[model samples]
Target: MSNSNAERETWSTRIGFILAAVGSAVGLGNIWRFPFQVGQEGGAAFIVMYLAFVVLIGFPAMMVEFVVGRSTGLNAVGGIREFAGGAWKYLGGLFVFIGFVILSYYSVVGGWVLRYVFGSATGGYIGTAGPDEAPVAQQYFFDIASGLDALLFHALFMALVVLIVALGIKRGIELGVKIMVPAIIAIFAILAVYASTLSGAGEAYAYYLSPDLGYLIDNWKSIVPAAAGQGFFTLSLGMGVMITYASYLSEDENLGIDGGTIVAFNTGISILTGLIVFPILFSAGVSPGDPGAGAIFVSVAEALGDLQFGRAIGVLFFATVAIAALSSAVSLIEVVVSYAIDEFNVPRVRATAIIGTLIFALGIPVTIDPVMVDLYDIFAAKILLVLGGILLVTAVSWIYSDKALAELSKGIGSFSGIGTVWLWTVRVPVLVVLIISLYLGIDSFIDFLAGPFAEFLA
Candidate 1:
């Protein structure tokens, strides 16, 4: 069969694809969610477990998607069907739908980050710290989140994402990622360094780096799923984002090294976020608020509010978040566009415009209602993501294992150290763990909707 991918967009360079993948993976989840998970899950223990998932599961899962997309050289739905046959093509559609659902709420959250950047720039949150911090940050978040301001910023964020996707691979997605990824890293690195200079910095390091074995033992039930979810979430797996991104990669690029690079950069930035956030929060004598939007918009904002050069720090911090948000949003929106272009033969620009506007409209309710955002977010993160992951691995293992391995092994040194492990990873241990992760994710979400939740960290 002729490779349809030959006719589609290709990254101009290997670094472009790697950076774009990293950008997709390292978003609000890394900056906002990872730190809280570390603190809640006994620091180093959670890190160890999460890394195990990455090494044993996450990386292989990623390779599966890459093999599917690159081998078929098509969008998620088309690629799966082309390779796997039967009703399996619909599995790709499911991922596209999940991506749609994710972007609807994700864009709204990105808008919230946008408002924070603006507020930080103008020093609107400067005096809201100390005793009144929580109320001020909460009030500010709710006001901006529900008000027309959210819609405005949401539109702006969406427009930026659409513009990039419409520009094609070489000129647009790859280019934007090249600039955004480095800027995100440099600014965050500077922020982390500055945070380390704070008086209570040692305390922050202890909280962030020290392992609490007792806490791990006590909270193992809660910690397991959180680590599993974070591993998938931080890697941007199970959402068809990687499938579409990998479709653009050429035949010469080695999937193992490229995937590893993306993971390294994405994981490094997440760890850097912890370094920046904990020190500031500790020195300011503020506990990380409950594990939702409060951690970033409220608790961290309060901590930064009292510091010298706080305004500058806040701007830099939120700026880093804004870039991460946009980068990830770009990939999500592109997932939608790629599906349309491949399956429907729609023009990239027109597809992007239509899908981007619709997602923007869909997000309005989420942006307006705090409850809606929370519910939709929980559903996507826990249910859709986890289930998508299970389905993804199953398809790769049963339907197209040999084909995936063939694609992945191309232009590589030797598969001795890697291929056998990656193959069984999809077939056996990884599949079992993903099944468990899905159960845990669903059980957690059920408890979430039950109100005043028990055991599970919200």
Candidate 2:
């Protein structure tokens, strides 16, 4: 039961590790959150700020997690403790908490996605009648998005996550991501090509790619925070996912190159998703600015239902989401699972089982109520995620600066010069933005607590 580096499982290959890390990074945030944010925040302008934040903030912050994980070769909690010791372990504890809470509601959404996949194949919602006068797809989404069917699907999805993580690093996670990430990219690429041929493709492309500088300049304050949050979440920076995933890596792997590649792939996939989504919405004469769950479940579903061969395409789209969700869920559950296995000397299967069941039980409220999903996200995912990132960056940049640089220097040849730049980036801009984002997130979260969240607590 000793969780030594010698006994611990490492990723089988560099590419396998990259794919798994990319899988962890690319999730509903890319497919579900990104396009909606783009639409809601003025399309190309938001994308512009998003990409800027990715380079300026996300990449360096990611490297901080990479160095922390690979240096300790331990789970999130153990990793921070190994390097910084004492109270710093709370930083890693925050990671475990975020992973646990986020996955609860995340799986609920995953379940809805699975239902959509099945519904698409069965034409369950394609031509169905609405109870009232609402659109069939919209009504169908409302029905399945919460309640009994949602609970069942959520359990089903969480079971898949637990099964994969319980199988250990190589056999389960590496193997799963190798297949899933490539398949996700392939499907999105094909869909983007098909989407380009849609009727309103021209307008969609214009809206998605052509930024109004005036809009960005005029709305930089709001757009900047939204884009920063999106960039941070999409890269999976604040969640300790990168830390957990990087722990499975070998020393010879170039961390800098791998980080860049993962970011590149994740960013590209996110943009490609927007390309596929906007055109479909535009073609169907559906506005893309509906935001959040409505953008994907109702708007996209309605659009797909109206297209030729729409049912088949819907199957592919939701299936991709299901896969993406599962892939990300694997990493999230693993953060907690790995923590248990590494710190408590618990067996992987037992840890996955106990932890997965607890997470599923936690998700029940969100499944039944649905409103808890947003509440859980703002309070658990966004706030804690930013806090974790801030703590990790501070610990790396100040408390363990030299050691962090040494670890980052390993396997990075010409990139060795990056240590100082990375340090300052982590110290200055990354920390500044994360702190600002955390403040804004807390402000909003407190507002929620005072409003609807208070009602939920009651």
Candidate 3:
């Protein structure tokens, strides 16, 4: 309270801040992709990789982000300027710009989730998830995602985001996440418990959790990148989202503890999502299911359709997804709003309105053209985000260097012996991993465009 300013706000409580962080991390990925990956890779082995990734890459990078934001007390752009100075000032703008490009397409995808929510409530996809109707499920997604429907829903989703963020940090983002995060956790916990009671739940559990050291060794090549990427990404690092959020924190707040807490909650929700998913899937007799891009839409939707109370279950799952999507979307848009507030001296409302509208306008193309959506998603996930990760690593390594560590070391053990280890890890190994991942991702995306987009455009 000592450093209070009329122009800025801090989280009302540490708990509220943690909740918002968890909400940001727990997104559509947890519900669908994380669960399927757990099931596919053998739970124990995947969890091993997940924990390793968190410890090695996610934890250190997260603390550096917090240190930068809290020390400088600004959004990504200004924070970098404060910490490093010189040409580095403009470097923060890269993250801000990355956030903008990401949110534009991200909102469109969120709109698609909203459409699914309505469909779930109305049982529109009720029988469409049946084996013979797999094509119907695919068609259902396309039908809602294209043309006018897509545009309207995207607008609706962004409107909700604009409304919340316009309320500013304390009243809007913090309050909203406090409610949404706990509710998401509670609902998924309920689903997990319910799933555990299903007749074939044991089989799902064994498949999801049983240790498979041999499997881990056998598949380490493919598995390492997957776990590392998800671990880093699940924290929403490198987007300026964390930087913006942490900028609202009091310096006395424990960056190390907060980062750990966020990871713990994020991992818990991911596990909860898996427990809920695999059990219900086994009970519903949907097999050959591994968590991937369309896994949740296809398998989860199918399982819900097969259930006795499918209408209610359908509503619950999709509603959970909607909340998760909204939570992340709030962070994405807030990055831009924070940048505008800092850079241009704009009123929060005016900044949000203009930026929100502009981002929504950018999404119109994705709404109209699914091909473009796929392209943007690929570009964002594969290229922009990887580049963002590398940039942060470089910034903390050479740009911020000693200052970043000194900031992190303020009464925190994270800045000491082990912290030095963290520094080198991010500089060499982590940077190497990210760069290689970027190369592989771009290669895969090009192949995808060559194969699928080529046929579709033709």
Candidate 4:
């Protein structure tokens, strides 16, 4: 490659960089996972706790990742090693491994979204809409989520991710995010406006927006960890994805302001998603606590099917999700490719190809088995994120220390005062809460597994 091409590969305009990072941070975790988690954790209460965690914990943790990335201009492995010295490089390796593991399952769900988009266009699930939409959607979802059909779509999604990253930073990553982010927001906004007109919209809003203080008291043991994990997942934390994105940023950007903007945008989109989805589902008489991730698909599509513009709405909604999922998947692929290029000195195109191929291969199990899809989803969402957050906290608090803090304070003048508060008070307490929350979450999860719910899995 020419030097000009190589130089072009490293550069991204400020807006492009911000959009790209926000695009990665905002995806299925926000749209799909957030509403469901809120439904389970008592809606408004979960939202309140989640917002607190996002502002206090997620934001500071994001800044630390940003600091590491901008300070070293290296991928996760190189950044950790450079900032924390020799013994801490393994922490970087841990991040790379987690990122790879997450991509394997994440691509599976992205493929499902791809399948649904095409299915909606072809009128596959249109006739199957019902009051108890969960069961109907589950059957259709199960039929498509496994075996050769899923594998082909997963390969297709992975291929798209590879093609984008192969184009390098500016033309590929930044440009795609620039287009996709606005498209996602515009489409979701249109849906939210339409949902507002539904007959059961008022009841749906109450169900989703009203504070259920009693549920919070009953489930606080489970709710804390669920909220924290959801917060981390929505921000794409613990997988080194943000760290990779931050590596591309120039020092002139204020880490505090940029990180805050990303978090706010991500959180805002999630809130909009809830407004769009829950109102529609509840207005249509669908319960919010419906089991399985496919519940949303079933409920929303069924409601849309009954409307005058049902097919059109269904097509647009699924299409929005497909675009959002693809944007995030591309970011995940970029993280892996960035590491390959930075650590091994591999060409960007070659690294993208290699990592994409590996993810495609690893996604096979999830694609071929319905059970494995749910298993992988649960493992990644519930287990991997909590463990990854723990590692991130340990690395930031104990290993990097003042060096990380110093890098975080650079360029952003106001950040020095607020950043110090973040370091000593906010960061430490949040980490402690995450640890305790993880323990409670695991205990509750195990108890749930061993209880009557075990039969459902069997």
Candidate 5:
């Protein structure tokens, strides 16, 4: 709080900001959720819908976050209050809360990735390495996914996220993403090429890329919501990440171009992930199976084990996952840490430590029981994320339309026409799509909540 707005840290370069934003967008949501969701839904049809939603819903929503952040040059709560004062701060607080709720369990999954890295390196999980590896990998995942090992790795992962964030925006976040994002792209690109040479690549590509329009038409009701959720999830929308990252921008930076680039890179990386995962699984005669950690840790891990040099590939693959998870976790934690430092006068180091500890503690239930992870993931992804996206678009489009346009106009230049078009996109298509996603998500919300409530009442 001692530092003026002028003294607050900003990205050292435009590319640095973009990489950090892309890093936030590309995480387990892309690598973990995208492939399984594609498989569990109708494969190519789901993917087609996801891409459409990303263009229609995700991109505009991201622009809204960027507009809010860059205009105010403040954290989510302060940024909203700058435009619409009074109780509107609660909306911003909801964003900060989403960051906490997400990173809590998110880091648990990050922990699992870290353990997989170790397990792959030492042949710990490769004993039954083959096409039949999934059942063994499932048992292996079940064993370490909870209890003391899970707790230890979860703490370890949280520590890494806190360390990077505590280093501050330029040295911590920007620097970390600069290194992590390229490595993610490079590794996945290489993996995609390798996966392409597999015999099943033909079938996998057909399944992943060749849209079944008839299937999509038949399943439009289900596929649309899932696609919208994935679009929001993969792009890091509805989570205050874009808002926090954009806050560090200079006035003249082009939000539209940067937002577009981030979305492009995120969607490309997610598609690359599907390329790597599906081909490998099909080559091994293993289905991607149902969504969740099983799709990656069980199915993909098993497929990797069946290949030549599978262990080495597993290490490299899971290490990339670890990097992606850490990069995204940094943004999530920064959302809260930046809030504390900006609004509460807390030092960066102290805020990170205290907040990181609290998040890790919140993840303890996730370590104690896998059910906690499912409940948290479903609620956050299905309901909270979509709801957040809808509210943000509503705020910028209706509540602060003039202010939002003025901020966007700062560096818009030749893209000035986009400002008006984007406004309507936010008002209609983005809002309507997200509302539908939220409504469809209610069934899942109820299903996930019912299990825990049933257990509690029993």
Candidate 6:
């Protein structure tokens, strides 16, 4: 089919489109990062702020991206240029590049989950460390985080992503999401139920739910940025992944309702993650305050080691996580591939291969060096995401204001009345908040860079 004809074909069903978008949004960010961020950011307050941002900022931005994609029926660069004009085409390119960088590091992390699932199945790391003490588990995680082992797993992960994208939107991407998203939710529900039976589950619930306002006060400088970043990441913003996915959308669907549904599902999974993870940690007598990625792997692995059917539980948990991670990675790769297809007129398969090859090459530093991996993760999550958000806000608000409103108002008859509300109230205020949040996020990241030397010595 011609590209335009293909674009004309909307999702076979609304559920399919919602499932696909939710699959892209609900991933490692929801399961892996959200719990840890909540623990670090004083739990309840951070959760509240995150919800607020999702409603005020993330929801509107999602609508904007959906409008841009469906209205133009083009990938990111083409969508922005067509909707707003030539001046903002660079904004779309920025989104594509940001998506590229994010997927590079994200694939590495997804590879780690793939390895963990294998290890869980093989009973590796079981019985190696006590729940309250995870030194051996931490070392095991570090060993896998570096060298040729890491590279192999990254390649394996990237290959899975490429294969899915090569299958085209309807056959591969949408179908995979339809299956994976439901599976993720089902698995998480089962685990959350299981976690509630742990000895100190009550304490875990308290830790996650109770608001320690003082912690938020003391850590506001750090917590706000963390919350904002997590909010954006959880919703898959600033990456053009949403734009690419939405490009497949037909105008008959309601962007606002779909966008709200996606955000709700994504945020719900994040909360579910906290429910599952914190209970397990607290029950195992592990401190939730331990910073760094190792905190999750070591703590959760140790907890699983002690359970009655720990091996099986570990396998299921990590398998779910790995699937979630891979699903998001595929979405990210699609963004890059879509840009290639749209801008360079490359075939979808060729574009997928080309982008996959570049990611495979760029992933080496992350696989070989622990420090580089951390730096890459930090840069993509903190710096590039905020920059992408700023550019998107500029493009949507100033350049494409009328077009955005018109597109966003396509369906839902009188509900379009709120277009003015979205633009003047939600969009403008959130843009301002994003600006302030971006500055603070950058500053906090710089401080983290500067303090590492002291932390190392200590």
lDDT of 2 by residue, 363-453 (tens): 9998766567778876764577778888889989988899999999999888799799889988998899888878877777777789866
For candidate 6, write residues 272-340 as lDDT tens digits: 998889888887787776666445777787777777787898889999998898788878888788777
Model 2 sits at a Cα RMSD from the real structure of: 1.9
Give the TM-score comparing model 5 with the true structure, all chains together. 0.96
Each prediction's Cα lDDT score? 0.81, 0.87, 0.77, 0.77, 0.86, 0.80
Model with the higher lDDT, candidate 4 or 5: 5
What is the lDDT, from 0 to 100, of the residue 146 in candidate 4?
79
Who is ahead in TM-score, 2 or 4?
2
| Per-residue lDDT of 274 in model 4 | 91
lDDT score, candidate 3, position 236: 81
User: Of models 3 and 5, which has the larger lDDT?
Assistant: 5
Misplaced by over 4 Å in model 3 are 1-6, 36-48, 128-136, 211-224, 288-292, 369-372, 411-418
Residue-level lDDT of model 5, residues 41-155, one tens digit each, is 8889998899999988789899899988988888888887776677776888989888899999999999999999988888666556377545666777887899999999999
In model 6, the clashing pairs are none
TM-scores for the candidates? 0.94, 0.95, 0.90, 0.92, 0.96, 0.94
> Which regions of candidate 5 fall more than 4 Å away from where they truly are?
1-3, 129-134, 451-458
35-135: candidate 3 lDDT, tens digit per residue:
65665566768878887777777777787788888888888888877777888777688887777777787787778778888888887766544565555
After superposition of all CA atoms, the RMSD between model 4 and the true structure is: 3.1
Backbone clashes in each candidate structure, one number apiece? 0, 0, 1, 1, 0, 0
**Comparing 1 and 4 by TM-score, which wins?**
1
Output the lDDT of residue 332, model 3: 83
lDDT of 2: 0.87
Tally clashes: model 6.
0
TM-score of 2: 0.95
